[model samples]
Target chain A: MMLIDTLAQGLLLGGLYALFAAGLSLVFGIIRLVNLAHGDLIILGAYLILTVTTITGLHPFVAVLLAASLMFGLGWLLQTHLLNRVLGADILPPLLVTFGLSVVIQNGLLSGFTADSRKLAAGAIEAQSVDLAVVTLGVMPLLTFASAVAVIFALNRLFYRTALGRAFRATSDDAVTAELMGIGPQRIFAGATGIALAVATIAALYLGTRANFDPSIGPARLLYAFEAVIIGGLGSLWGTLGGGIVIGMAQALGASVNPERQILSGHVAFVVVLLLRPRGLFPRASD
Target chain B: MTPSRPLGLIAAFAALAVLYALPAIAPRALVQDLFGVLTLLVLALNWNTLAGFAGLVSVGQQAFVGIGAYAMFAAIILMDLNPLVGVLIGGLAAAAFALPMAFFAFRLNGAYFAIGTWVVADIARLGISQWKALGGGTGTSLPKGTAKDMAFVDRIKAALDVSSAAAADALTYWLMLTLAVAMLVAGHVFLRSRMGLGLQAIRDNETAARSVGVDPVRLKALVFLLTAFGTGLCGALAFIQITRVTPDAAFSVIDWTAFVIFITVIGGIGTLPGPIVGAVIFYALQRLLADYGTIYLIVLGCLGIAVMLFARRGLWGVFTGRTGIDLLPLTHRPPKSAAPQPQASRRTA
Candidate 1:
């Protein structure tokens, strides 16, 4: 019964990881560019929410939409103007460019926010809980998990069932061929980055409500998100969720024995997965 | 005709001599700060070797830096070794650890490869936080007695303590400068060798390079180890200068690695002087805008985006490609008469 509770909690925690990894997975899947700034951008979204809430006195839910929309615009412009230029066969340019962006974002936040930690006010919903036959779970955690599932489902549907998704996959497979198909690679890339920022906004919503965050915490978040993406396998949304669960489980179990080991446990699980299955647990057939 | 690449060498030496002589004429604080900046330059150069030339984008270089620092601390505190020797010992310790890590991290490609490096770093942080001898979360300081001994010996038994700080600072600056030059030269030589060519070939196209008999795996692994070694050395050097080491200080991804990435990007990747250019620019920025805090970060982000968009080849590449300035002589040029511009253009198109 205790083990079941641990597993349940771990699975719920995995939902957050999945949320973090989804944006990263999408961006990497489409452009093969690992946005080192992804985690920082999520934190920036959280700050945006905090700003909206403080200014308008709106509910957190409404603030999220505002933040998401703002971030989406930022992402679109960034890709259209900046990142599109560096997308190429050589990986160094993208990595170096993103790495530089990460620094700029972190420092920008520090200067703007004064390095003080902030949290989103979620009211009663934060403490609400649901009890199962064997264990109890937080309502927020459950919602997070459900959101992860919905996101993966929606993304899958979009990728396979929509024209935009086809463009994304086609561009991923062969940018030149997609260009020949009259699909503007630049526009597709901008759309992809915008979508990624939307996902980042979702991750930021949970992240702000879940814990107190300062400007400096983004790199660690990026590390965890990256690990989850790698563990789940690149280019698979459901696989990313699975990878998140593995990490969340490892962290929770490690915390159960020793609180300090929580972060370490997630990292350990990632290494173990890498050693045993270098291609990840569910790598795409084509990849 | 063989190009006049040696002119670049003369210019570099002249620059180095000027930098080395700044301590004689500049303010004391500025001289000390230059020493600090030079240490950062060492790290930037090391990272450029792996990521720039070899095409391995690692986000977790702090792992080796932390390991090297801890090793330096242990060597000085436990074995009672000289601080200078401790830096070398720290580097060796990092290299020893990196060998096994490379075996595992080398298996993944692209994004996976990058994440694999961070995983190793996180694991190292966890282990360090648990170990009691290493001071766990509280962190440990270098023995004051050792520092005092080194200082006193170098002071020639001065009548007062005035010579102590100066001697210690000068020794550290000279040691750091020597090591930085040595590593830069070593890196330059390595990149010019057959192994370096193999690494560059792999970066261009792994499959194509493999088809051409260049062993991609071996080259990647070798570059990874080389990067680890240089990082370890820089970590140890930094540790000695500070006279203390902490898990957070050693492992904090922000202090050194991010700056290097910024430097490499701003300077130019795949060019020898790029990292050096980047270091100078970053140090200048930090000095000028240290008070702006978050605004500085926003500016950095904006600048990064700007650089990526406007100069895809980075500051050095864009400026030099257009102006034909070879400060470090990393590129070769065909004779003006023999330059086949049309053929190159056709191939690219």
Candidate 2:
């Protein structure tokens, strides 16, 4: 029973982490470019929600939709105007360029909003809990985990079932061949970044509700996302969730032993996995 | 060509000597600021060597810097050595650690290499923070008396007591200026050597480099160690300037890599003086916009995006194309007109 409880809580937290890693994974899979700015973009999305929520006094869920749409546009513009040009054979340019973007976003948020942390007002729903025979779960956390499953399922279906999804997979497989097949690489990348940012918006909603967020916290979030992506293997969505569960369990277990070990434990787990599987747990066969 | 090289070297040395004498003449505060910026310049240049020329974009250089700073603080506070010597030794110890790390990390390709560096940095931080000897999470200060005993501080005190403003400013100025010059010269010489050529070849195409008998793995490891050595040295200099060391301050991955990336990208990657230009511009922008903290980052981001999209070669590439000036001259061969005459080239130019 106790083990079930631990697994349940970990899988839920895994949802939030999967959300964080989803955007990161998609961008990497489609473009082979790591978006260092991903975590900051999530923070940016949260700030957008905070702004709209405060202004309209809407529920956090409603605010999330607005934020997601805005982020989708921002992501599209960012790719079309900036990132698309730097995506190429050489990796350094994109890495350096995105790093600068992360810094800039963090600082921009810092200045726009003071360093003081803010959280979305989730009301009683946030405090509400669902009780199972063996354990109780917070509604927000359960929803977050469910959403992660839904997102992965939806993305997988979209990737394999729909025409647009076929284009995305085709482009990921071979951009030149996709272009030969009448798919525009630029348009596909723009669409992927847009979808990634939308996922980031959902992540921001949970991140804001689950804990306090300030500008400085984005890099830590990025660290978790990177770990998840690496742990699960780079391109697989299901693998990302597994990676997050592994990390989440490690942190929880480490915390059980020593509170200070919480963060350290996750990192140690990542390193241990790397030692055992240098290419990651589920590196893409093509990759 | 040798004669011209000597003249350049002498001029650089003379410039250093003159600057070293400036702290005596300049304001005390200004001298200190210059020293701080110079240390940052050293770090930026070293990062440029690794990420820029070698095509290895490491996001965790803070590992080396943090280790060096901790080692320095530990040596001075516990071992009772000359603080300056302690700092140098700290740098060497970091290099020793880096040598072994490079072997494991260099095995991974581009993105994996970067992620591996970050993991290594996190591991170092975890080890340091958990070890009570290093003050763990809260961090510890250097031995209290060491700051007063530092040679730079003593020199500054003497100048201040004598009211020799120019003399004090000059000494501090000269020290920082000399270190910065040495770092650049070393960077230049390294890039022009056989190892540097091998790194460039690998950067251009790893398969091709191996086809020509270049060991990509070994060359990358060497570059990693050398870059760590320089970065470690920079950390020591930073410790001297700040007079303290803390985990967050010393191991700030963000500060170490972010501004360096901006400088390298904006100035031009894979070129020696790119970081120098980037640092100067970055420092200037920071000073000018100190009060607008968040806006400063936004501007930096927008600038980076702009540079990546339009000025891919960076500000140096732009200026050089427009005006044809070669100031720092990290490029290996001169322009066609500047290259040796056909006869001179055949005669071992």
Q: Best candidate, DockQ-wise?
A: 2
Question: Which tens-of-lDDT digit does each residue in B1-349 have in candidate 1?
Answer: 1244477667778988987766445555776898888888888888888787777778778899999999888888878888778888888888888888888887777655676787788688778888788799888888765655664445532532345565566667767788789888898788767778678777777788899899977787777887788889888887777887778889877676766667777777677778787778877788788896555545555666677667756777776666655555543355678975633311100
Question: Candidate 1 — which residues are off by over 4 angstroms?
Answer: B1-15, B18-27, B151-162, B205-208, B322-349
| RMSD in order of candidates | 3.6, 3.6
Q: Write the per-residue lDDT of candidate 2 for residues B235-337, one digit (tens) a residue.
A: 8667755666677878887666666667677776666667777777877887888896566667777787788778777787776566554445544555678
For candidate 1, the docking band is medium
Model 2 misplaced regions, further than 4 Å: A1-7, B1-15, B151-175, B327-349
- Which residue pairs show backbone clashes in model 1? A104-B301, A107-B297, A108-B297, A108-B298, A110-B294, A111-B293, A111-B294, A111-B295, A112-B294
- The candidate maximizing lDDT is 1
- Model 1, A36-144: lDDT tens per residue? 8888899999999999999999877789998999999999998987788888766666776677788777877876787888999999999999888789999989988
Candidate 2: tens digits of C-alpha lDDT, residues A154-261: 887887899998999899988999999999999999999999999999999999988899989887888888889888987787888888878888877777778888
